[model samples]
Target: MEASSEQPQSVSVHLARLVIFSAVVLGLIVGTLEVTLEYKKLRTTLFEHSEQVAKAFEDIAARAAANRDRSLAEEVATGLLEFKSIASVEVSDETGTVLAWKECGQVEAFGSWLPFEIPSAQHTILLELSTPSSGGEAKGYLKVTASSAQATQIWASQLGMVLISVLFGTALLAGTLLFITHLYVSRPMLRLAEAFRRLDVSDPKNSPLPDPEMFRFREFREIAENGVRLMRDIKRNSEVRDLTANELYRSQKRLQDFAEISSDWFWESDRDGGITYISPSFTKTLNKKTGEVYGRTIAQTTAEPVNTPKWHKLGEIQRQRRQFRDFRYDMAIQPGEVKTVSINGRPFYDEDGTFIGYRGTGADVTNERLIAEARNEALQRAEQASRAKSEFLATMSHEFRTPLNAIIGFSSLLSMPELLKAGVDRVTEYSTAINDSGQHMLALVNDILDISAIEAGKRVLTLEEVEIDGLLSHSLSQIESQAGAKSISLIVEQNAQVGTMVSDERSVRQILLNLLSNAVKFTPSGGEIRVTVDEIGKDIVFRVADNGIGIPSDRLPTIAEPFSHSAIHPHVAKEGTGLGLSIVRSLAVLLDGGFTIESEVGTGTTVTVRLPKNGSGASGEVQTA
Candidate 1:
């Protein structure tokens, strides 16, 4: 059908020949019609002219008839023949006998009556009239003939010239019109259509229309514009369809590779609040299959089964779909024989923020949740035990310290000048022993108090604005003595541009102390530790690097687990509690901060802790060696 729809199977020839042929044909038709009309008009006019002449002749004949004189009739007929248009006049009696006529011999049958019919000629007339008679019998007819062979020749010559003139005029008109129409209308239209017919209609990106600048007609320009618009629309539609198909294919491929990924049942809706699409993942999650819920509502599909809080969780989102916000439902699901899922609803959206649909992942968090619950219970029991244990330890430590204080006071008295004279050596031994024992007992009490507070979760943080230089200087001071014991050198560098980090001053000091001590303990004699303070965005970042034994990569994720110790860190002294790093991690979370470590097996480990700067949102950067 399209093969024939285009400009196909056309015969062409020279312009001259085509115009000549068309002109000849048009000329024949127009000329014939014009000649026919002219003939009819002339014939009708000639008939009217002949009738007037006959009436004049009849008036004369009637006067003669009233006079009842044949000589008068002859004279009147002759007088009536004045018009050259009238060829001759004949007067006849009632019996069809010629009464009087002028030049009766010039016409045939002048005295005899023939059937009085109009004559045909280029210019010829036939007419008759009868006088009204008083008697019932009609007196006679006054027959008038208006014809001249010469006049017929004259009219014929005029008609012949008219026919020739019409032929020439019609030929010129037809030829000129055909040429002008071809130039202005037909030729331009043909060019425009021929260009369109050559377009590649199969490909979406194909250019289908010639440039509209080539079109001279406004109509053709408009046509070309419309074609370009249509092409653009088709191209866009094709792209969208292709993208949708590709997305579906990729999603299916991922599904197959993963071999039964966990399913989540979410009541899906679109920006218009209509259920435009749904997923089969729900059926698999619920230990069911497809077919019962493919085209049904959420109420019909879910295990909730009715107008409980679950079904209505998505109702508001459906109503406000135009706003493009997601509906959140923190609900639980129990797939029979499958693991229980603690689900959180998360919906997806387009760049316009229009709700596309809901898709979220679910994990079996049963073990993690149960462990956390047990930890909470254990923590409560430990707090109750710590109060009793701490009280007894404090009582014992105080009781022991009181006697030691008395011994120290009396021993100091012995060191006075008079007592020193009597027993100086004994006083020195008492002073030294008393001082060491009291300090030892106080240390045991403080350790118990610290552990007790940690278990009870009653430890408070004193957040302060510590400038960068002061913070680094103070932390270095606290750890300089520890590092010096191992013959380790400590270096500190601070950035002047680092604004104050809004952190618990004591806690920050403790975290830094723990990291520095670990570095000092692990480093062989003469090893080095470096502490650096810097500004990242609006946060203060602290990094501590040590050329000490590094942790295994496999233990990185679990290093922050409570009471868990990395094998690398155990190479140092083993007497310390394993809760230092865990305490640091928990405190960091409380302040919305983070800690990280990077290590190589034998080279070194670098730890970075990022804390929020004053008045900045809690975020920063840190890197470890």
Candidate 2:
């Protein structure tokens, strides 16, 4: 399966997560230890300071007691109360009489116990005041109570600040580590992966392996270098495989070419005798010029007498899954045409030895059979051609005389001076009739001469750069008057992309004009004519369509022959020389183009001409005589 295109998490992110998590854990442990130790140290220092203050006031208390002054002792105790941790202090005489006492109300006790009844380190301490005399006995004991609430609060605050610092430091450390990893590891790895992913295996010489020397770490750099080495090896193997595949393809092609050359036709059929594949040469031998005969049974393609003894024997052989060699049979393709072919076929089986199809080669033996009867066929063909020529001459004589007689009769009438004397208008009408007859005769003669020249291979072309849009417009304009007389709307649709083409301008223009004229001439009153010019690939296409009296489908094949007129459009008044399409077809061939016509009687007709955009530089012009 293909990998997702989404950018994935890098090694830097994963490492950052692990390192940041470890830093957070370590910070918590260190912060707890430091806060605990700080709480203990603050408690010890507070007690010691309280003891020292009480001792310093001992001498003052003794003097006060000796002087019998209680007020002075109270002042000493009041001075000690200034300390924040000191809750209260008291001075007593040797008789255990309370002489002075001082209390500080600002101190609030949090507690001596923590959660779960654990004893806290915070506590108060009492100290005694002793005389400096020889007895060194205690004159009065100073009472000191340290609440430790303030000290505990300070510790909590310090711990909070320390925790914040640890968090901030961990975040900064994580970011720094991520940046370093990306620079040294993740980025280089990503580049190597991308380069490998983009490597095209189909082209080994042009596609080089990526360089791994960019990595800073030795281990990763080693990995990249090894990857490059492996890729070089793979590329070498791929080149070898490519060479082998190309050689194999050439061998297969040579065998195919040999088979095609050796036999007149090659074919294959399914186990059910349905044709699967037939070569173009095979179809041409069968007199089928276009389309395919695949998926058809032999009985359907063969003549009506398909149950002959020879075919029966072939069927029996196929039923037994046996190979047949040099099996000759006659195939009647069309009336008056019978072909004899010798075929050699073998049943093809799949890997499991199950019958799949039959592959075969066939040679048309009709020519061999003809050689045996060539003398008889020659005599018959000669007689047939003679008869056909006589009939053609008779028909052509009638066709020529009709137009010649019209011209002669009209010219004779125009030659009379009496018609001119009758009126100038009358003379002008007769002159027009003579001119029309002369044009008809000229068109007939031109068609014959053009066909003869084409058969003699005398056509040549004058190539030029042709403006396609202008040519289409000119052709349509020339046929506009004729279409107007028939009340037919003439339209030209030119693609903007088909601005200009290189072709024989005269032949291209004449081809378009002939098609347009035919559309205008045959279409009924109120019919429509459309001409479209466009460029498709390397070719330029011109299609002329008309809602006219269309030709019969069967007569379409013979429409390109000279003097062949369609009998389907009997209602069309003006008779054509029937050479317009013939001349256009010839011109298309000369220019190395294609021509095709599609028509359905009583419906419409569409004529298409496809010519290469680049005109021929050789002899492509059809010289009309």
Q: In candidate 1, what are the lDDT values of residues 1-625, reduced to their tens digit?
A: 3356555432223454566677666766776577656656665666577677666566567656555568877886677566555666777766666777774234332212223422445333333334455444456667776554334344455556665776687567656866786777667777767877866556667666567887788988888777777777877887887898999899988765453554444444444333444445555654444455345544443443456674565566545542222322222243443333443345677898766664444434445566877899788657634743454444555556666777667677876787766676877777777776666555445444544465566666555576666766777887778778888888877776775666667667767776786677667778889888888876677898989877678767766554454323446434333445666665565556778888876888898888777623332232111
Candidate 2 segments whose C-alpha is farther than 4 A from its true place = 1-29, 40-80, 88-145, 160-202, 208-222, 237-263, 269-274, 289-292, 297-323, 327-332, 335-342, 347-356, 366-625
Worst 10 residues of 2 by lDDT: 111-120
Measured against the true structure, the TM-scores of the candidates, in listed sequence, are 0.35, 0.41
Which segments of candidate 1 are over 4 A away from where they belong? Answer: 1-88, 91-172, 204-267, 270-286, 290-339, 346-625
Global lDDT of model 2: 0.75
Worst 10 residues of 1 by lDDT: 616-625
lDDT (10s digit) by residue, model 2, range 1-625:
9999999876767888888999889888888798889988887877777767666776787776555468898887788787776778777776778888888885444433334322334344555556577277666666767666667767766777888898998888878888888888778788778877877767766776777767777877787788788778878898888889999999989867865566577779998988887766676567764244578756656654757887788889899999999977677766788788777899999999999989888778888888967967787656644643454455557667877787788678778877777888877776787777778678777767876777677766666778887787788788778888888987778787888877778778889988988888778899998888888988999999988888877667767765555433456435555668888988887788899999987889999999988764225333322
Clashing residue pairs found in predicted model 2: 460-621, 461-621
Maximum-lDDT candidate: 2
Scored against the true structure, residue 571 in model 2 reaches a CA lDDT of 64
Task: List lDDT for all candidates, in order.
Answer: 0.61, 0.75
